[model samples]
Every structure is written in C-alpha cells, then in structure tokens.
Target: MTQSPSPTLPGSRAQTLASAESLVSAYEKAGYTRAHPGILQLAEPFLDLSGEDIRARMFLTSGRSGEELCLRPDFTIPVSRDYLTSEVAGRPHGYCYLGPVFRDRGALPGEFLQAGIESFGRSDKAAADAETLALGLEATAHFGMDTPDIRMGDVGLFVAMVRALDLAPAWKQRLIKDFSRKASLAQDLDRLSLATANGRPDYQGVLAALTGSDPKAAHALITDLLSIAGISAVGGRSIGEIADRFLEQSALDASATLPPYTRSLIERFFSISSDPLEASATMRSLAHDAGIVLTPTLDLFDARNAEIARRGIDLKRITFSSSFGRGMDYYTGFVFELRDGTGEEPLVAGGRYDDLLTRLGAPEPIPAVGFSVWIERLAGGAS
Candidate 1:
C-alpha cells in the first residue's frame, strides 16, 4: 500500500491544507491535472535515474519477493512514470502533485509535504520553463512571502560552453557530472590543468595485473582477484560495473592536461554571478572573448527571462549564476531555488529536465520543467 499524507505530516493541519490547496489550485488553474504517485515505489528506477546526491539519500528496502523498493524521495520521477504509462503522454499535458515525499534529511523530518507542477510535451520549451518557474513564485507569493531570492542556472549553457571549447567528450562528461558541486567542479578543472605522465599504482595494477585481448577474460580475471581479496561492490553497484569502471580509469593517462587558455575560459564562464539580465550579458561577453559561439543558449535564456518578466516575477530580485545547478543530474536546463532572506534551505526549488523522460522510458525526449515547495519550510517562514 502507498503511504499517504497525514494531518500530522508537517506544520498545523490547517496550514498544510492551505498550502496544498494554494499549490494545487494554482497549477490546476494553469491546466494541470492532479497526479498522485504511490509513496512505496520501485527502487531500481530511482537507483538508475537519480543523480548521486539523491541516490545517496534514498530510503531503500526490499519486498517479500526480493524486489527492491524505496519510499518516494520526490514526486517528479513518480509522476513522470505515471504520465509515460498514460494514453495522453504523447501529447502536451501538465500535472500537479501534492503529497509526502520521504528522505533522510538528517536534522530535518524524514516525511514532509512537497507540492509542485510538471509540464510535459510543450513545444515552446522556453515558455514552459518560464511558466513553471513563475508558477512556483506565484504559489510562494500566495503563501505571503514576497521578494524571495530566485537563483537561476542553465546546465545546458555550461555544457554548451564546454562543447564549444573543443574539449574531449570524457572532459565534457566530467564537467557535467560535477556541475552541482562548485568546490568539486573547481577541483575537477584544476585536475584537468595538471599533467600526469603515466599510470598511478592502482591504474598500473589494473592495466598490468590482468592482460588479455578479450574484455570478458579480463573481467573474469579481475573479478576473481577481487573475490580472493574479499572486495565487494557496495551501494547497489554490480561487480561487472565495478570492473568496467576500474578498466576505464586504468586506461586514462594522468599526464594529459587542458591548455592554460582553455582553463582560464572555464573559470571566467563559471565566475558569472549577477541579476538575470546582466548575467546573460556576461555569459555572452565571455563567449565572445573566447571566440566560442554561445548565442543559441543565451537566446533561449533571454526568451525564458522575458517570459518570467512578463509574469511580473521581478527580474531584479532573480539572480543567475553559472555554477548554481542543483545536484540532480536530470536537470538539463534552467534550475532555480527560492528562499526567504534568512532561510538555510530553499522554500521552493526545481528546473527543466528535458532529457529525463527519454532517459526514464519515454519513446522520445520531451520538454519538461517544474518546481516543488517544501510545506514545512514555507510554513515555518510564515510563522
């Protein structure tokens, strides 16, 4: 059976009800049908779909039949699954979900209410992105918070810049993977700038300890060695995957590094932190200085910003940062977080996940964006 939101979920019953009503009604007015995904959901999908951060925090369990399961950590993944299973998934549709999402948040409650809308199949993606973000802001305003800090980012734009730099695909993948962590991202860039001549000890062993033209034989030999050494794959990763990772890392050359100019350009790109309009200009300037074409990404950012302004969300209060994406890998573009002046955690946060549906079983890619408001955080600020 699925876990449902209770009156005692968070805050006062009345306050929770009011916030739920406000969010659901707001999204419904924008043509989103209500969607409720089961709380006890399959675990494998999340294990495969979510980024490392969320994957680490999931509450995992197993059923009587030995099937892995997890308490729902967020509504987006579940609702997307619901939509994909529906007849109308091929067409554009909007969905609103308000319920308890479980997670191990350390000091915070494990069970809390999250309310949000998901827009799918919209042909005008930039408008859809703006509309969802604006809706989150409007819902927050409905709860009486005004002038919240709105931090925006575009993961796609950063990836685009990397692509323009003519970096290797391996390098591009590293940047995207570390985009959500600023300190780690800087370390990643710094590592790229450092040259390494030959393999390290571990790499040397993986390359030299077992040698064969056939990968299957090499994999068997590695697994046998691991078994003898009593080393096992942890955190749901399989032995085969571990072996593959070992091989990939072993094959990498440590001495190869990026050029000084390219590293400087990367730093400049990430240094952009300003109001939405001006940050867009700064990105353009950086691209020009590097002689890398970034107009397409910047144009989309402009269109989305225009849409946000058209909704009267006050672009002045909205800042855009180049390295501000959340830890969720599915966020392909336009990530934002809304918070009161003094709150440690965001009251509302979300972004566009354009490739997510395809990654999560849709026949083709769909344009999607949405945000969720934390009931406790929102109500706590009000109190």
Candidate 2:
C-alpha cells in the first residue's frame, strides 16, 4: 500500500526554519541562551519528562544504530536534560532553542520549529512562573502582536483541593489527569466506584493499600496489585508504579475538602474575562468562601495580577477565569492558555510543572514552567 504525503505541512522546510530562527532570536534577547548541541535527541527523556499527552502526540522513530529517537516536539525536556547532564548544575541557567519538531498526520502531517526556554535549578516558583509568562508575552510581542490576550489557571490549587478531599491517591491521580476533560473524568469516577464496590482492586483500592508509612509493605502491596491487575512494567512504570510513588511521597493534609463548585467553577472561570487583575480577585474570593484555604496558590495569582497591573495591561482587554485548567497530567500550578479573541484554541499554553523534573529524575525538584506558542497557528492567524 502506498500513502500520499500530507498537504497541510509546509512545502518548503526553509520557511519553517526561518520562523524558528525568529522565535529563537526573540527568546535569546529575553535572556534565554542558545543551547543547540544537536537537533536530534534520545526520545525517551523527552517522553519521560513531557506529560502523557505530549508523549502521545509525538512522532517517534528508531535509529539504524538501534536507539529509539524522536523529532523533538517540545524543547523543554531536551533542554532540561542537556543542562542537567552538563556542567550547568547547582546554578540557575536559561537556554532557548529553535528547531523543527515532527508529528505524523493522516491527512495533515506537519513539522514546525519550536522555540522556547527551560529555566533550570531555580525554586522561586513565583519567579519561574512569572518569567515563563513574561517570556511568552515578550515573544508574542516580538512577533508583532499588539495585544496578545493571556489567560491563566492554577493546577497546584486544583491538586491541593483534590488531595484535601481525602480521595485515595490512585483516585486522585485519575481524577487529576482527567480534570480538564469532564466526561472522561466522570466516567472514570463511576467505573472506579463500581470496582471498589464489587471488591475488585481498582486504582483507589491499590492506592489505599499503599498509603501507609511502611515502604516494604507498600512495595509488596504494589507488586501484588500489579500481578492481580495484569499490568507489567513497560518503560519502567506499571499501573502499580505510581502507587508505590504514593507511598514514598508525604501525604497532603486533608483538613478540608475543596469547594464542590471548584471544578465546575473552573470551567466558568475560563469562560470569563482575560483581565489578569480581575481574575485574581475572583479566584481569591472563590477560594476564600469555599474554605479551600487557597493560601498556597494565592501568592502566585497575586504576583501575576500585579505583573499585569504593573505592565499596564488593560483589565478590560483580558478575560480571567478561576476554572480554566488546561488538562495536562503534570501541571502543578499557574496554568494558562493565550487564546484568540474568539476563544477556540490556545495559541500559546503552559504552566507550573514543578514536580515534573523530579518525576523525570532530577536530583532535587526543579520548579519549572514554559509556554509554547503554536507558531504555525500564530503565524497563520496573523497572515
């Protein structure tokens, strides 16, 4: 069988390369150093660091040398790995790169240059989140957009609320992963509840068994659950793999359940204004009255609002919503998407992924966040 090429991809690779260079120049001017050792990278590190959705979205290949490789879809993972493995550790570093990332399409195969930065080894989360947002704004402005709208959300609060509810870790993970996708989350919750009631060890039961302080017991229980669930270690994580993680990690406080309207309200928040300051106030009030003790997330929200205000961004020109979660599995806090005024798809998107670097084997957790503007979309809309 013969397959035809996709027409949506650029006819000339040079155009993509040129666009990528422009983005690279913009990021570099904003203090992101260039770090292009090699355009190609070992795919697994990126897949491991990127959220599940990103991994799924990539176009992978196997080298003739028998190593698995991929055309990099996002730059942060490779940038992080390069920095961590290099002499750049123990000190803060920022690097930007521009390169083509490949993705297969049945009818619209495409490749585009991705330009972004990874701020490594810094734990000032507010600073990191702010810098990422600032860079995105700067990059957009450099691209000549007069007033690129920015929308934001906080996944840390979302996770905190989930943990505070005292849901089992497995249930929490499943719910967290699906929070942005309402129908799937609802269905999974129903399915897990059914499994728990039927005496089969669903994800929640697996989590409950491993929630105690005993590491040995947790490992044994996880092993048994894996065997029972018929899941195996693929790429070093079984269905039970994250269960063991639950045991090793300190449990979150459960003194209060987050407001019932939290999730639904988040949806509404996204539906509202892009005015950063106004959004912060709305979120604060919601968290306060809901008794969610939003203290942990409020600072970042305030900082962002203050930044927007400081920049003299028109509150009326932006729409802010407390509930605009972009449904990635790894976002920890300060999530957002820059949408066209019509609000269909995010032209630029990212947020706090503090825990992701650690999950991918950084010695200490690196509080990190960066946004990728869909260059093609941005350029297309402008044209």
Candidate 3:
C-alpha cells in the first residue's frame, strides 16, 4: 500500500515562507551572514554525528557513485561544513539559514521550513551562550511569543557529574552515552544500583568468559568468531562495532554494580529543576555535600546565567532541568527549547555543540552554538 501524504500546518505556504524570511532577517541583523547549503548532503556525517534518534528519521538516498546521501535533516551540520571550507575557517563566524529540512515524521509533514543561526569559533563561551539564547528568544518574539516557556539543560554539567562519580570507566561512558535517552539512562541507573540486571541470557557464557579479559583480545576473538560463522555484519553494524559491543557488554557484566552512594548522587543531580540561579546554587550545594567537585561546571553555568541576566532577560522565565536533553547527541552544553505556554512541542530549539566541527574534519575543536525556529509551528501559533 502507498503511504499517505504528510500533513501541513494550518496556514498558507506563502505566509510560512514570509515568517521564515522575517526570522532570517532578524538573525542577519544580529550579525549572522545568510547561508544556503545544498539540499543534498553526505549521509555519513549526519548518520555519525546526529545520534540514533535522528538517524532513524533521516530520508536517505544514494548518489550516482553509490556514496550514501540524504536530504539535509538540519542546517547545523551543513552550515558547519560550509564554514570549514571557507577561507576564514577556524576563525570566529556566524551564519543564519532559512530553508526546508527533510525527515520522516510519520503523520506529520516530512519536509518543513526551518530558520536559525550558528555561531562558531567563539572563545567567550558564556557570552556566546547568552547571545544564542537571546537570539532564540528574539526569534520567538518575532512570532509574538514574548514570554514563551523556556526549558533548559546543560550536557556539560551532566558529564561533570558522571565523571566525578566513583564508577568503572566503561560504566561512566555508558551513563554518559545514555543521558539523551531518559528510559535507558534510568535503566542504567537501576542496573548500577543492583535493582536490576540486564544481559542476553543466551550470551551469558560468552559474556562471562569475556569478562575481565583484555579488550583488544576480546574484540579480536569476537571478530574471529563472526568470521568463522560467516557473519560479516548484522543490522548495518560493522564487524568492528559488533566486536566493540561485545567488549562493552563484557565490561558491564564484570562491573555489575556501583557504590550505593554513587547512584544516590546521580539521582539527586538529575532531580534538580528550578530557575537557572536557584538550580546553580542547588547543584553547587549538592556537589559540596557529596564531596564531589562540580565547581567548574557550576561556575560556568553561573557565568552564563549572569550574562543572560545582564542582557535583561528575566531568570524566572527559564526553567533549568538537570535531566533535560535535546535527544541529539552532539549538544555538548546549554540546550534549550521554547514553547508557547506549556505546549508539548517547542517552536524553537537549539544548543551548543563544540566538538561537532572537529568531528566534521576541522583540524581542531571549535566552540559552536545555535538554535532553529520551526516556521510552521510559529505561524500556526501566531496571533
């Protein structure tokens, strides 16, 4: 059976386009140069960098040369790629874009207009973060969302908390990786707390044998086993990835559980939800009482809050949720979403993704942050 057509917002296409254009104009006035990246992009970058949530929704195709390609899912990666090849790559630059991005939205439209700005190479992280937030608010204001509900998070702070925990290296990596998935992260915490155990019962023997073995040796063994069984790959995963998974499983099996206090600390940290300033104080206090050093991350958080306050944005409008994440893995610090009233969907969303440039082939890390406006959502909600 053929699939049904995707649904559009309740408005004229022309009106939505106009709204997008106005948003882009606002970003340009704020010093972001207009960028128009091609619709088709190399698929590998998006597949690798955008995380599994996006990977599953991507509208993929193949180029004439058999190289995988896809419609631009979002402008951030494409825009970053364009900046990297420019003459001023690695230097501070800002870009704004407005265009259609493609993804599989089931009943919703698979293609829609998106407008936003990306700032790269900024060293003043706190100031840059504040600027991104301000620009996002301005975009919402353009649609009469003067006091939209703001939901904020900081992946950097989460990373700091995980790093300070007393746990095995593999466990720490697992927790950090699972942070974007609330259910998975909670399950991991349960496992760490000995409240539950997870593993494939069929692979119990193999996991046990591999446990405490040299990682390299285990990987090689798994690779050799897969070869012997004539299994070159499984579910699009490379043999190397499969091997790595086995190694990770073995590590997790060996570790089994964490210190009880560690789990309590993580639970407390994730439970924080308050205004930005209050959240910062609560985090600092939690760290101090737990004897873990989250001062650096907390200080940066305060600095960014101070910058936001200095710009005259009310702290009361921002709600900082310690467990909040954009579900995209690339966001390294300061993620946020702005919605009309308490709507479930955000009209605007973005975050800082510092390591994305380096992962996309930059010689070194470049600090980056930005947000995207959903033109259709804004137009639908506009008075």
The parts of candidate 3 lying over 4 Å away from their true place are: 1-11, 195-217, 381-383
Q: Which residue ranges in model 2 land beyond 4 Å of their true spot?
A: 1-20, 63-67, 188-274, 342-344, 381-383
| Residue 319 displacement (Å), model 2 | 2.7
Looking at model 3, which ten-residue stretch has the lowest summed lDDT?
1-10
- CA error at residue 93 for candidate 3, angstroms: 0.7
**Tens digits of lDDT, candidate 1, 1-383:** 22344666565766666767766877787799989788899998888878777788899999999999999998889999899999888689999878888888788677877888888898897788888887888867877886788888899898788888766565677777778877878877776665432224445544544433377877787778777788787566677788877655444332235788888888788788989899988888888888999998889999988988888777888878887888787888899999887876888999998999998888788888888888767877332
**RMSD of candidate 2 to the true fold?**
6.7
lDDT score for candidate 2 against the true structure: 0.63
Q: Which stretches of candidate 1 lie over 4 Å from their true place?
A: 1-11, 196-231, 234-237, 251-255, 381-383
Index of the highest-lDDT prediction: 3
> What TM-score does prediction 2 earn?
0.72
RMSD of each: 3.4, 6.7, 4.6
Rank the candidate models, highest TM-score first.
Answer: 3, 1, 2
lDDT of 2 by residue, 113-215 (tens): 4566777666666667666776777666655665777676676666665665545565577667766676776675555445444653335444444455487
